[model samples]
Target: MGTDVDIALLVKELCHHDAETEWIEFKTNNSDAEMIGQRISALANSACRLGIPTAYMVWGVDDKTHDVIGSSFRYRLEKRGNEELENWLHHQLTDNASFEFAEDVVCEKHVTVLMVQAAFCHTVDFERVPYIRVGSYTKKLREYPVIESEVWSRITKSDFESIAAKGGLTLPDALSLLDFPKYFDLLGAPMPQSRDEVAHYLCDDEIILRQDDGRYAVTNLGAILLAKNLKDFPTVARKALRLVQYKGRGRSEILRSKDYEGGYAVEFESAVEMIMALTPSKEDIIGAVRVQTTAYPERAIREILANALIHQDLTVTGSGPVVEVFSDRVDFTNPGTSLVDLMRLVDNPPRSRNQKLASLMRRFRFCEELGTGWDRIISSCEALYLPAPKAVEYEGAGGSVRISLLAYVPYRSMSLRDRVMACYWHACICFTNGETMTNKSLRCRFGEGGPSSSTVSKLLATAVGDGLIKPVDPETAPRYMRYVPAWA
Candidate 1:
């Protein structure tokens, strides 16, 4: 069993199963390094072939009786060659292939569990040979030509989003399972009066496909974007969005939380509304009237939320896109790391892991077309005089992409880094528009038009000193000088 209590329960549950599945295997106290490596490779490949996220190799359990017989295996401390066992395993496996070993005590018996992530986009190999699990036995993949071919096809040809959420359902059942009305509403099409017509519409969109058996298969795309209740489809319920609000700057103080369960299109509006309500706002007095403005720009928040939803990795189980609100900022974190470099987010074309989902969200007007969302967020923040939002990739186990929208901070209160970043982003935007950063433009960005030109020059010089921007013509007169980002 692993360090997590849930993993311990998972081990017990697997042991209770009548037999080992294609993605699950049992091992005794045998800790032969080569054998363990081969098993890990086999489980990983088998899991990919079976379209599962992870495969399990549980120790301390009997194969035949399915009994918890305790394992003395301590592979973590074992060594192969001059390297540790884990390091040796890593060197043998394909790129991005990973596995974890956990130790626990169950009912006074020591147990070790190995959790292997499925090979993705490539087949996993050990000692220059790919292995797979056939029933409960591990063997060289090429030994079974038929299975080898099938596994390779699965690896090279399959798209997770295109997989059917629920296969072999009747036309009526498929229609009943999804919210056709909302789909039509989002698409700006009138609802069909008949079930047959609705089924035809869904089929046309590839949401459901007609099978030879006269049944329909609901694709993951359809279920995730328009399912009546995402929970009805077990594989996608974890993809639902969760919103949490804290009482203060840290998470120690709890306020409120909600896990949105509706489809993305159905729940997006309400989720945004809830977030805006929880977000603090200020009262502004115009010349003759009063206005209420939120702590963060609504348009920027909407774009960030949509990006998180459409760009998340649907295959990651156990977690999904999360919106966490603290006193000073709102954080958007999704299950997968960004496809594009965080530093290039402002100028690079948007890259999404889920292209189909992105296309649909664009069609529904949930987000803009490719590459414009970040620009919009930046410009919106600039227009509001708010600090530019931050985008970063949190690197670790189950890595994620996070975007934070900081609360409104006056330009006088901004830090040196903040000023440099704002100037750099302003230059990026200007260069994108075929212009250059000037003292006047920089002053306008900070809403400090009354400041002397020399004062503005100091800010620009500070940016240049930090190597964030450079003068286009160093010898040009100060009054005629223009600047661009250092990389530009």
Candidate 2:
């Protein structure tokens, strides 16, 4: 499945493995179509059961002596009745089974190889009966119920990120498909002088796996994080961030939209820059020149965007992270609900469905300190005297999480739910800082032009009535009352 160089290396490597291995079969010139189909099913199932990514069948090698004797097996010219050898075998196997055959000259002899992809979501079957390799012998899967069960269990626990997004790549193709420079730059390492050295690093990181055939397999994690163009990998292409700008606050009217086609690491900065450009800003006069300041802090937007990409549930097909820019607020929505309690997101340690993605992004400096993203978003908003951001989880069909960052809204115009949420988030921030929320502090949160002290006090009372916050000391005077999050 790789280049000629790959085939030569593979032939040499296969000679080293024990012929009794379940995932490998060696032959000198046997070209029986039916037997080959059965071997394909057996090898695929065995590979899956053994946690191997690929299975192999090599021709032109002595099974006992592992000698490089040329074979007359020309799979491309063979026929099964009126059907081509490859076509007939493909039709006999289950839809989940995949294989390819290659013929090349290696060790000065004619060599042939049949490469089979391991069964992933389901066991491979030929002729409507599953088969598996047992000590170099092919047998019916039903004869071994325990192995069948184990294969099913492995399928059930398979990780989407670990699956190959695309396979059968040469060294140059693999390097060109990913933003290799960005990857090394993120780690603050200089690019290696040799391409193979670069590949060594990628393989060590589990980004690109070196197949037994000397080819490369680009994993879903690598493609999602570093692919030069996501379109090259169909599985993760739909995972790219989609940004939509509305003429107003609702979705009915469309202004403009864009779907970033690069990997998360490659397009993160551009996505944030686009959002900031669409964000509402106000002009403020200083001593000399006027400065334009965005309503939402750039850091807050960047952090939330990164969170969305890192926390999204990759199992949810056909959906990805989305950014909706409205006149008054920006919403960052991903394809999964929060793993932690909604109320505890600010203080709880970070939990993500894609820990590998999160860890890599953190290493790239795209993420805030572990568990401090929400804290930073909250603190940034508070510094601008802006209404607190809200994190909501809509549950169902693997659920979803949406983080909404609001622009400045007057206290009087804020709905009761908005006011209560603001109070709760404010208390959460104060509690996280080892302090408690107070009337004067709440007033300052709303800025000097906010309503009177009594208005802030009434808002705090509403939050308490809603059980989102509680007085730190019940016996304290009303003027000196302080509050912490209800759970705190």
Candidate 3:
């Protein structure tokens, strides 16, 4: 429906309220920008206290009789000194609360409505002072310390996804800004015939919130996953995934780099494809023809990239997930330390800082549904006889986790640490699949050109000596012995 029709319905609903509310004010030709600013703060704070998502001030309505009389107010044309009224109010508000004005004809009279989102994360302040509504009167928030504290407490507990990325959008504006068709396609649902049904679905999925003023607000979840251009949402524009290709194994010489501008889901496949394309590959003769082989398995790369995006801390500002491709390794780093122990990721249940983002990515089949992502990466490495990937966590404020996929290294040239890690990861993968690592299995992972049986045994002994893996049965024959992860 058009904005005009929606505005008319909203006006009717507001008129039906039995009494004037703390969250709503009726005025006629009250064009004072300073007074409007105070009401905005008071109404926004009151809405939070009452657990309401939005508050409003409507003009062209009779204050006592609730009648829609024609208004002479022209908010769009109002100016304070040299600045527009809208811009001035925005600069004066402390909470960054999104408030917008919309004008339409209601009851055959011109009516203007100002919609204000409730205080979230901070109390709304105008001109350096906070305000709140008390029995329909606007008063300084400091005069009511108890109410101010309650607002702060409630605001801090809000979910990150509920925060507005962009506000005051009409249905058409929202549809144009987000890739709505792709959203339904990912969910495996047929498109609804009516536009209203589409809007309802988006709101139900928490992608967009329907406002009291008949406008729409894009949630962080919606913008992160479906925005056509992330730049439209300034709060999350910098959260776009980054990919860098280096000339060698260091950050000094960057070969190529890109910052994906679209939402994660929209740009995911293309990003993976680009990463694999930049990956080093060689030609190998298989039976009669030469086949191309990549330094890392494409399956492993996909899982790693998806995990980095899904598990990242969305609250972290200024940084996002990054994939760096060196000549010898690919490192996937994201802005959050691992919730699962680095050593036990193969067996631990999946934990994510952004659960909603993870769930949606899984629904779209971009990542694993079970906690087998790490297991698959390990197994793929074993299949190709490549060295096992390493996962490390950096702890502290602004800490992050990085997982590196290394190129194949000759067994004779591998370091002791590399050999021990290979054994531990093999045991981990085996234990996850209800099996244990044996000498023969370990040798198979090293391929046919690998070391002798005795050499493999020595490596296993070294791994055991380093407390990386333990024998399942110490009493078992040397040739028949099986090893499992030490923590198993």
For each of the candidates, give the backbone clash count: 0, 0, 0
Question: What local distance difference test score does each model get?
Answer: 0.81, 0.86, 0.85
User: Model 1 Cα displacement at 38 (Å)?
Assistant: 15
Tens digit per residue, CA lDDT, model 2, 1-488: 23333677777877887665888888988999989999999998998888776678989998888888989999989999999999999799986676778888888999998878778667889999889998988999999999989888987777667766766677788788899899999899999999989999998877888876567888889999999888887668889889999988889998999999889998998889999998878899998999988889999999999999998998776789999999989999999777889888888977887877888899999995479898889889988988889888897877899999998888788888887887888888888898999998888887878878898888988888889999989898999999999999
What digit string (tens of lDDT, one per residue) describes model 1 on residues 1-488? 11322445556766767888878888888878899889988988897788665577888888888888898788777888779998988888765455778777766778887877667566789878899999989999999999888888888776656656655456777777787798889989998999889988888877777753355667778888888878876557788889999988999977998988878888999999999999988899998889998888899989999999988877776788999999989999998878887767777877887877888899899997669788888888888787778888887756899999988777777877777788888888888888998998988887743345787688789989988899999999999999998888
TM per candidate comes to 0.72, 0.80, 0.78
Give the candidate number with the greatest TM-score.
2
Candidate with more favorable, higher lDDT: 1 or 3: 3
**Best-matching candidate per lDDT:** 2
CA displacement after TM-score superposition, residue 88 of candidate 3 (Å): 13
Name every residue pair that clashes in candidate 1: none
**Model 3 lDDT-worst window of ten:** 1-10
1 versus 3: better TM-score goes to: 3
Scored by Cα lDDT, where does model 3 land? Answer: 0.85
Worst 10 residues of 1 by lDDT: 1-10
Q: Give candidate 1 regions above 4 Å deviation.
A: 1-140, 145-150, 285-289, 448-455
| Ranking of candidates on lDDT, top first | 2, 3, 1
**CA RMSD per model (angstroms):** 9.8, 5.2, 5.2
